[model samples]
Target chain A: MTSILETENSDNQTQKEITLIENILKKTGPSYTKYILGIGSVLTACLTIWLGLFITPKDEHLGNTVRLLYVHPPVAWAALYLAFGTTTLASLLWLWPKTRSYFWDKIAGASAEIGVLYLALTLVTGSIWGRTTWGVWWTWDARLTLTAVLLVLYIAYLAIRQLDGSDKTKANRNAITALFAAIDVPIVHFSVLWWNTLHQTASVLTPGLHLTVPLSMGLTMGLGFLCTTLIWGWMMKVRYDIELLKVVDSEIELQRAIMQRRNEP
Target chain B: MTTNERLLKRRKLRIVIVLAILLVIFGALIYEGLTNSIEYFETASQAVANRQTLGTSDFRIEGNVIGSTIKRKNEETLFSISSGKTVVPVISNGSPPQLFQPGIPVVLVGHFAKGNGPGGTSLLFLSSQIMVKHTNQYIAAHPNRVKIVKN
Candidate 1:
């Protein structure tokens, strides 16, 4: 009887040790990937600031207000990146059975949220700059109109994702809808070009080099893109982990229920 | 219908409404862009050089006050804005802005009607309001004295 009790105590201690180890492993496993991405994001952001502030020359026409273009264009691009990223991820999840749809669905959700944030920033900054340069706070520019449309669409995307239950069917339905809504992006870009509006044409890259922009401006834009991407990626990972933990907790509850039933019998 | 189906239908309806609203906004914007005249912001010097084309048309004129050209005609006031090349006469029945001086940027909104010249009454000036540009330091020092007055 004494030996049996001692063995039982030891077994309990061993089980506790194993559970602690499992928890630690789970917590630490994603840290390395997240840290690398985080560091890269910081470095890119620093590079963007350096290029925008120091490298770009003041414009002959717009003067200091030209600085806004550096910040504004990249934000617009990052928003576009988010929209595209989410749609692509959603498509992949829907197509591939092997891929866990929930994981990418959460990522899509995160990207949409961040995309809206940057899009809002882009609009506000662009409007302020427009006021100073064009003597008006707002204009009926093609590019501006398209941007507004994109913003509303993605905001709808976010709202739809949040409204329903988190079951697999619900997630799949929302992901599919998001994927379909992405069709607007190309249409927006194309319509802006076709229509004559106050918004200027794309500056950073075009088919033929008509205007020679300073190298600093390009670097600044590139840096801004990298920083926003890294931040978005990190946020998606954190959210994904939280969802996984919730699933694990539910599974543990189910195991406890089975154990209780067996003991009663 | 199930609650879920009803909710989904409502969401779809909302999306359609939003899209329609956006379309109307887009249409209005296109119309405004096409109809509104495009004008460039310029100082008095540039305005004077292009006075021929600028004649008898609504424009935004920027210049410094010519000290001698200022005169009071009863309830009406007259002044000449000099860009160094030509002096553009301005007739204002309204009170002058606080910062109206011989050497500052003052934008006048009106058309150039018959006065200063074939060059007479160079600009048939009609301004409803005036804004005096001051530095942040200047504004802080004399906050009450530097208000923008609308005529």
Candidate 2:
């Protein structure tokens, strides 16, 4: 009798464990990695702020406005290069027949959304820095112009991704749009080198092809990139999971409604 | 051709046409950007010669600051910049940059608007901003220790 009772107890415990795992799979609550990323980002951001504002010396030319350097360039790199680059790669993967999957679509869409957010931040911070250093809020210069255009292109790409149609239709439309928008990446990068504009050329990329920032400034910028990347990556993963779950939940509801209609008197 | 193959061919053709249109638009934007650039500023002599053609359009003018021509008035800095043999009067708002000094090349960005003077007649470059032109090379000096390399 005790052996049979122990078996029953073990079966009940296994049932409880299954339910817990199911809840985690459903993503009804925050997960461990989210907490890790959140805490890491917050801590690193505080350190970068301290280093940028306190430890770095004032630039010879820009004075205190030089502090904008630590925040602006790293965010721009994350938005303009890393985020967009990933979107492009994911879009390409989705387009190719052999490797086509919703996984790539989810990544491309998530990265584009996060890219827009960071791109907008880059523009705002760049404008503030411009107003102080160049005595104007904006100029129709090459670098600024292309960056603005890139922001618009990706934003429109995002809007196209949201059209409520068949999954295949929306995926094809988004993939094609993304493939074309990726062309602007090289243009925005080369704009500074090719054009005459009020905005200064890149300083971190020294003429000697070396990074020439002061030690503290470099450290601050490195920290800034790490924190922003971690946070943005977490945001993208959360968003993608939610989107996939929404589709699955909607499908379940559709099947339930169909069954109810068939059983109607 | 079969119905399905014909349809596929038409879709391919449509894709090609759309891509062509996008290409033209992208090309135009890049071309326009190249024409209107950071160095779009004309010299003062060129500004004067082509003032009629440049009516109402804001542009930049590059010139050397004429000696002793920088004057401080309320909320404005009045200066004269010379390019070639011609001199243009400039009235710009905002404090000049740290590197701002007489005899250095500076680009003034603004429109050529009517000036207010005793006669209230001629036009001047009403600049909202000024920039000191420098080279791409960055060289920092300190007593820590250094070796200068020849290029």
Candidate 3:
């Protein structure tokens, strides 16, 4: 009688365990929220392109090249401030023993990969605009040179993450490298002010937060900013999902290896 | 070691060496580039003040175009740029960019002419290229401005 009662209790316990696992799996899997964000990003990008190309007036001075303002500045802001800023904060969190987690390290790595994409876009778009307006495809001015350096630095940061190491060692290395690369962000920002560079200073983000550009141009640029940021957000979610899968797969593999060893013994 | 193990070891060593060399090259390039770009250009006033010391050296000068002084001749465009009270006469070898106009700032890349100025009162800058230096401000094309541009 006692054995039968114990077996019933064990069955109940297994049922509870299964329910818990199901809840976790549901949480980790993709949901409607990510898809909704992805759709929003696509729609906003289309709207930005439409308004930038057609609705906005040609700049009094820049003419049609003014349309590039929508592309270059927004991409640059996303790359330099948004993506790298997230990586820096996440790296700091990982470096802090109290807050250290694989979550932060994975976020840093994912954000940096996206940062590289936006940085390259920033360079390409800016180059096209420069050729039309500034009469050069590239120059060795302070701002341009520093921006190029920032790209190389982040590329190196990503490469460092690929080296063979234990998880802890890799995380530590990545976190440190991210912090080192982030030192260039402020320098790139202030280069125009500190040196004689061909690149112009901020338009909307001036010293007093004054809007230098006209209202229409400013609003279109703001929309472009929103579009790029939304795209970054959607990309981050997808990247984080992939990173979580890798972590989960490794955990499972480790468990399977231990089980096989136990069965052999 | 087995052949496979030896091959893997050789590959790892090769990667390490390549990475080390790349790191050194990158470091040197950044150092040199940063040092050179620190003072990328001089203002018209600054360039004029240092003309004696900067004789015939290739550099860039930044200034605003004096509206009344732009003139074009065969294969050359001539303009005067000013920063504060110092105005530098520029003789550019080619056509300026599309946006280049009076009252706009520009960065001219070249050096001081070998000889004296037009009247021998000041030096002339011989420019190989002209880059329009736009400000951050953006003004929409007003109706009046559009008509003016068309007329």
Candidate 4:
């Protein structure tokens, strides 16, 4: 019958698509480069911890609490600048007419997931530092408040991605939501300057570019930045692989269903 | 409906509920921040200018401590904080923090005094707490060079 032949043809097409997706997945699986990045992240992180805890001299004002500077600022940079910045950039690329691709969407999602982890660390480390230096565990200051809002905004972005929709529809929704969330980044950065805040302004990244920190502390903090960025890179590569695997997994499931139907009486 | 369709519908419902909760939390945070922490504290000069309007209500004032003016009487610590030309005398009920010193910036939480003390000062602010507000500048204390940190 014509209907039976049509169904057979559809199954054949699905089989071909599955074959193609499987090939792509095989080519894109974990590689030597990812392993190198993983090793580098671990080694650099250990070195940073050693230098921060032992080698870094006591700050004249902050004393032993100055060690937190190495952790807090680097984690903040990774979250606010490195990871979130990548998400916004990837989202922008996906929104562009010429560069629109699911690749950008996946990259945005992965970067954002990692960014949330780093942002949470930023808040935790900052709170510990705040308690020791500022004499309070928490305060409703502008910088702290806006940073909290930034975390919530990104949380909403991740939730929006979970809404049931077609791939294209989800991509569009995520891109727009990421763009909107990015509006808060600059506001959070300038909150101390724009408003009366208990939080101190930027120590190193001041307008004049003078290193507010000493040479030894600055170098250790720089190493911390490198360590965090490498960790982010390794995580991003693995997360992107997982996204690819999801596509392959769904294809395999469809292939199995088709074979089962063909075998049915 | 098929089992797949039912599962999809349930998942979507869960996501929607989560999104609603997040939305409410976000709204509450913004509202709380706008009213309470947006304007963190008034400076010493501003607080003095608006003392009558502020009345006995709890508020925070930021200023630099005048070291020479700091005095301890009984259990109370008395000090004068200045912003520009305006100086506000403060009487704290308890001992100040370890880092509390002259020429350092601090934020004091309290209200305008309802009455002049035994010394009969015309203007005085009653402080319940004092918090040292350090600056962004850092001068490394070299063993050879004695570094003076100015906030």
Top candidate by TM-score: 4
**TM-score for each predicted model, relative to the true structure:** 0.57, 0.72, 0.87, 0.89
lDDT-sorted candidate list, best first: 3, 4, 2, 1
Across residues B37-116, which tens digit of lDDT does each residue of candidate 1 receive?
Answer: 13323456676666676666666665666776778788666877766676677776666654455554455666666655
Name the regions of candidate 3 deviating beyond 4 angstroms: A1-28, A253-265, B1-25, B28-32, B116-122, B147-151
Writing each residue's lDDT as its tens digit, candidate 2 over A169-230 gives: 88888999998888988888877777666666676654565556666677777888997898
From the highest TM-score down, the ranking of the candidates is: 4, 3, 2, 1
Steric clashes per prediction: 8, 4, 0, 0
lDDT of 4 by residue, B1-151 (tens): 9999999999988888888988888888898789767768999998877766777777888999997999999999999999999999999986676668889888888888775532232368899877778788765555565765555
Off by over 4 Å in 4: A1-25, A28-30, B69-77, B93-98, B115-122, B143-151
Off by over 4 Å in 1: A1-30, A95-100, A208-212, A249-265, B1-151
| Model 4, span A141-237: residue lDDT tens | 8888889989999998998898878999999999999999999888988888998888888887778878888888899889999999999999999
DockQ of each candidate's interface versus the true one? 0.06, 0.15, 0.52, 0.56
Query: Which DockQ value does candidate 2 get?
Result: 0.15
What TM-score does prediction 4 earn?
Answer: 0.89
Question: Which residue pairs show collisions in model 1?
Answer: B113-B124, B115-B120, B115-B121, B116-B119, B116-B120, B116-B121, B116-B122, B117-B120
Model 2 steric clash pairs: A196-B37, A196-B38, A196-B39, A197-B38
Mind giving the per-residue lDDT tens digits that candidate 2 earns over B10-54?
A: 766665565566556656656766666645678888777777777
Which interface RMSD values do the candidates have, in the order shown?
Answer: 11.1, 6.4, 2.0, 1.9
